[model samples]
Target chain A: MHLAVDISLRQGGFTLNASIDCWSSALGVFGPSGSGKSTLIRVIAGLAKPDSGYLELDGDVLFDSENRIWVPPHLRGIGVVFQDARLFPHWSTEKNLRAGMTLETTGMFSFEHIVKLLELQPLLKRSVNDLSGGEKQRVALGRALLAHPRLLLMDEPVSGLDAKLKEQILPFLARVHRELHLPCILVSHDLPDILRLTDRLVLVRDGMVCGQNTLEGLVTQRGAFDMMRRSGLMSFVSLEVDGEPVRAGVRPDEIMLANRPVEGLSARYRKPGVIVRLIDHGPTILCLIDTDEERLMADITPDAVRELGLKEGSPVWCFFKAGAVHSFD
Target chain B: MKSISPAEWTALLLSAKVAFGAVAAVTLPGVLLGWLLARKNFYGKVLVESLVYAPLVMPPVVTGYLLLVLCGRNGPVGGWLGRTFGWQLIFTWQGAALASAVMALPLMVRSVRLAVELVDRRLEEAASVLGYSPWRIFLNITLPLARSGIFAGLLLAFARSLGEFGATITFAGNIQGVTQTLPLAIYSALQMPGGEAAAARLSVLSLLLSLMALGFSEWLARRAKTGRSTHAPCR
Candidate 1:
């Protein structure tokens, strides 16, 4: 599906100027907490109208300032899962899940099928008031799907959840898209949220679309890398294990940088490699090493890297204790 | 004094009927206006708010005078009704009920509006996205969520209607077994010689009715304050 949106919206003190022309089933809008990411989702769902521009989804004009055409939210056929899971208090879990169902909406997203897909049988009769945060979001997703909307808009669906609850909900979200093939826009601040679902990223910062490209493509650019890194206070990271029966994990900060291989040290697992990239994060810096076997990321102080004269393409040795690398099945 | 004179019973029954009719008459308008005041941001909203409060703030006698001029026998509205439908509101129980309803409207609207405002607009937005229209959203979501406040308002209005005097006397006129509700009955009894005992007994009856309605209204209001606000699913 092709969605072309060129709009300018001002809400109170914040003004958002965003434009996107993309053809992707699942899209991710990545930004910080106050970066107007959710506002973009709201505008797409027809919840908020932009000041001047047009939004054409699949060649259908949802909004057009020049022609004076604007579709109301109910007629937009775009379902949204709110961050708070705004379930009806008077409704039971079953009622909430079936809120969007009607005579015409039966086949592609059926009530019985959704109940089974979300494992909502045990929760159907229960009051929405009694459901957990994760359960509420699941019911919300089911409710949105049962409406048979043409597009789905999710605003921080799992960002509010704790790690364990987030883990529990993310797989369900992934399955919903994989099985149903519903075109969706997932808006979130965290990288994992975008990576788990779609590679197409629209990086929003301070109410502007700073970059729109694939994850690898955007990160290679200097400005996109700095904005994304500072937004979440997390280093751009990826993991790959090569040539071993064991799966090992180690904190990037623990992998200290050294000029040469130390013959006798308390730490184990010394590997010499060339620094491919160095991302500065204020006090500490991240060094991407391309080892003989694989590429590994290590975190070290700027002083350490500066003292070792380590720049891009400079050969370096990385050290970490054997106890630091935890093995997982 | 020892027994409620057949006349006193007439007065009690008439008052209950008038109060019930008053409550029924105001329920629809009360809810509609209340929801409007709470939800809609429009031009001249303050004018509407003042109009709703007029009956409560202005002397009931002046309001009755206005109603009498509008709906009196030769008055335009009353003449139209009399000519078209052969209906008469002047010096009738229906006029008494109408007067009572007007007097009770502010209380009902106040409660309904407060409760409606407490309902989360986010939920209604969610409903709209789910394809429910504005009317369906109000009926299914807003009204039900605000049920407790509406009930409390109904009781308060009922209590207010039971004690209506100035408007009913001015427009409906106090007549024995017809427009003479509790307060009017007590007043009528006191105007006669050696009627102190009858007046005292009927006054006590009026007091009991008011206390009961007030107690119920207070109970509902307390429950409304303490129960079912935002159920944090996250908890």
Candidate 2:
């Protein structure tokens, strides 16, 4: 399904002006906090009315300011999984799931299929107030899926979760996309969370769509890279070694330093580079190394930096394993 | 532990009947108005709110006088009702029930409105996305979640109705078997010579009734609180 949105709205002092069109099944919206990510999703979900512009999904006009056509949220057939998993407090898990089934649609998602897909059989009898955060999110996903929505919208579904819970939920999101084949828009401020779900991203900043590109493509853009760096996205590089293309993401924490290239080690990718800059982080130092093809950032401890006498213009051998490299086509 | 007399028995039964009638009369409108006050924003909201709560702040006699002027035989509303429905609200038990309902409405609205406001609006938004109509959302989600507050409001209104007097006396006249509720009976018992024993006995009954109502409300509130905490998996 193709989705098109071009909308502008002003509330108080914050204004949102964004326009994008996407045909990809899973589109990730990445931005920092207070960056109008939620506002965009709210507009598409019909929760917030835009001052002007038009929205079309799969050839249907969802909203058109000039034409004065606006479909209410319920009739739009768009399902949203909110960050807080806003389940009805008075209902059991089963009832909450059943409440999402649209009256006019049936046989799309059966109760048993949803229960098994979300592993909700054990939680069906439990009160919504009794479920954990991860469980609540899972139930919310089931609820939305059971609605047989034409388009799915997720707003920071795993933002507040710990590492373990996030890991547990991300796979379910991927499975939902793959198994259901539903078009979805996932909004998050976390780069890794968006990477886990989809590679196609729309970068948003200051209530505007900066650009839409792949994660690798985004790193190459100057302004987008600076925004990503400020938001804690590590530098990624795509290179060609021995006439074979290689794509790898270098995490700031994984890059180790050595004065000379050591032999008898399992680390596959070792490159000799000159230290271009050294930035003092709170507890560690961020050292930027100028390799032949690209620049790599290494986070090294202050003690090690002092021991090695590392400074700007120093030559160092950067070592990392092939396993640490995340490759994409 | 004196045996109750026949006159006292009639007054007690009448009080229960009047209180029940008053509560029944106000519940649906009270809840609707409470939800409107809690959720909707419109012109004259403050004026509407003040009018709803006028009975609570104004003198009971004044409220009674207003009700008499509005619903008396010669008044516009009373004349229309008499002509259209052949209904009479003056100096009858129904009039007493109406007066009691008006007196208790503000408290009922306050409790219910507070509860409705406390309900997480996000839940309603989620329900809207799930294809539930506005009325269905209220019936299926809002009302059930606001049950505890509604219960508290009902009990409070019942207690206030049982003890209503000043408005009841002015609007519905204190006829023995018709409009004399518990508080009115107590007042009547005290006005006669050598009626101290009856007055004291009726006062004790009123005290017991009030305690029971308050105790039940407290218990329900505790249960609702515990239910919320026990089921809440997060802080």
Candidate 3:
């Protein structure tokens, strides 16, 4: 499937002009909050009309202001999973899923298949209000899949969820993208969530499509790296782990500190580095460690800093486990 | 307590029929108007809203006079109906139902409009993305979600119609066994000598009927509020 969008919309003070052509099965739209990521998805889903431009999906003209052609959302065959999981409160989970399935679309994904895919057998009889946040999102995904949409738009499906719930729901989202082969444009501010879903990224900033490339390619670009850094994303590195070069990322919080090299530990990597700077990060202190090849930030509690006598130019060992590092690309 | 006479029984039955007819007459138009007011933004929205609520604030006698001017035999709508369908509403039971409907309309519309307003617009947008047509979305989402309000509106209208007095007396006239509903019968009973016992009996019956209608309305609203199955099953 292919989608070509070149649209511009002006809403009060925000003007969004985005142009993207994507053919991947799943594309990630990564940006900070208030970056118009959701607006871009809304326009693609036919929920909003752009001021000027054309949108084509699989050679079908979904919208073309010059041609005066605009297809209503219902006719656009695009299903959207909103951030809030807007389920029909009055309908049972089964009914909400069935509400989107037409007779002709049933052949695409059978009811039994969706029920099995999303593990919705137990939730079928429950009302929407009875389901938990993760359950509701699964039901919403099933409902969207049942519609036989040519493309799916997901707007921060897991942002509202806590860390544990995010981990629980991310696998299902990836499974859906893989099993259904549903082309999706997932908008999210979280980098790990985007990386876990799709490697191809569309970076959006200030209502513009800043860059579109694979994660590795975009990370090398100075503009994209700066944007990611500003958004609090940790830097990634190509590390030789077990004789294979893997692209790995270590979060600031996951990096432990040691005054000297201590053997017989569970952590896989331990590198001695000099403390370049120490910055206060609210309750925790962020120590900028200058390793031989790269600078890594380690979050240490204020108590640890005082007890360890940590200061700039102090020698320290940064410890992180291989399991804690997320490998992408 | 004096036993209800045949004339009083006729008045009671006629009152029920007129109230039922009024509720039936106002339901469709009332819901349509309520939805329009809740969802649409037209040029004369404020004017239309004010006109709809005029009957509630204006004296019943003024509403009756306005109905008379618009629907009397010599009036435009009444003349058109008489010529086209041979239907005359003046000085008849149908006219009393119409008068009651007009007086109860504001309550019905208000309940329905509030209910419609409570529905989340995002749900409607989600429905559109699910490939539901506009009419289907309204039918499956908006209408069902607002059902409690619609039902409350119906009961309110019915109760108001049952207790309607001034508009019915002025527009349809108090004719025995025809337009003389419960309230009109009470009025007539209190006017004559030695009619105090009859008036008391009719008042008791009216009170019982109104109580039953209101009790049912409260029960329905409560059920609608708590009927959803919220407890999850054993995992």
Using DockQ as the measure, the top candidate is: 3
lDDT of 2 at A210: 98
Alpha-carbon RMSD to native, per candidate: 5.3, 7.5, 7.8
Candidate 2 regions off by >4 Å? Answer: A215-220, A229-266, A269-329, B218-235
Candidate 2 chain B lowest-lDDT run of ten: B226-235
Worst 10 residues of 3 chain B by lDDT: B226-235
Poorly placed runs, candidate 3 (over 4 Å) = A230-329, B230-235
Which digits, one per residue and each the tens of the lDDT, describe model 1 over residues B30-110? 999999999999999999999888999999998899889989999899999999999999888899999999999999999
TM-score of chain B of each: 0.90, 0.92, 0.94
Q: List the residue pairs that clash in candidate 1.
A: none
- For model 1 chain A, give the 10-residue run with minimal summed lDDT: A232-241
Ranking by TM-score: 3, 1, 2
What does the lDDT come to for candidate 1?
0.85
Candidate 1 similarity to native, TM-score? 0.83
The positional error of residue A277 in candidate 3, measured at the CA in angstroms, is 29
If scored against the real structure, what TM-score would every candidate get? Answer: 0.83, 0.83, 0.84
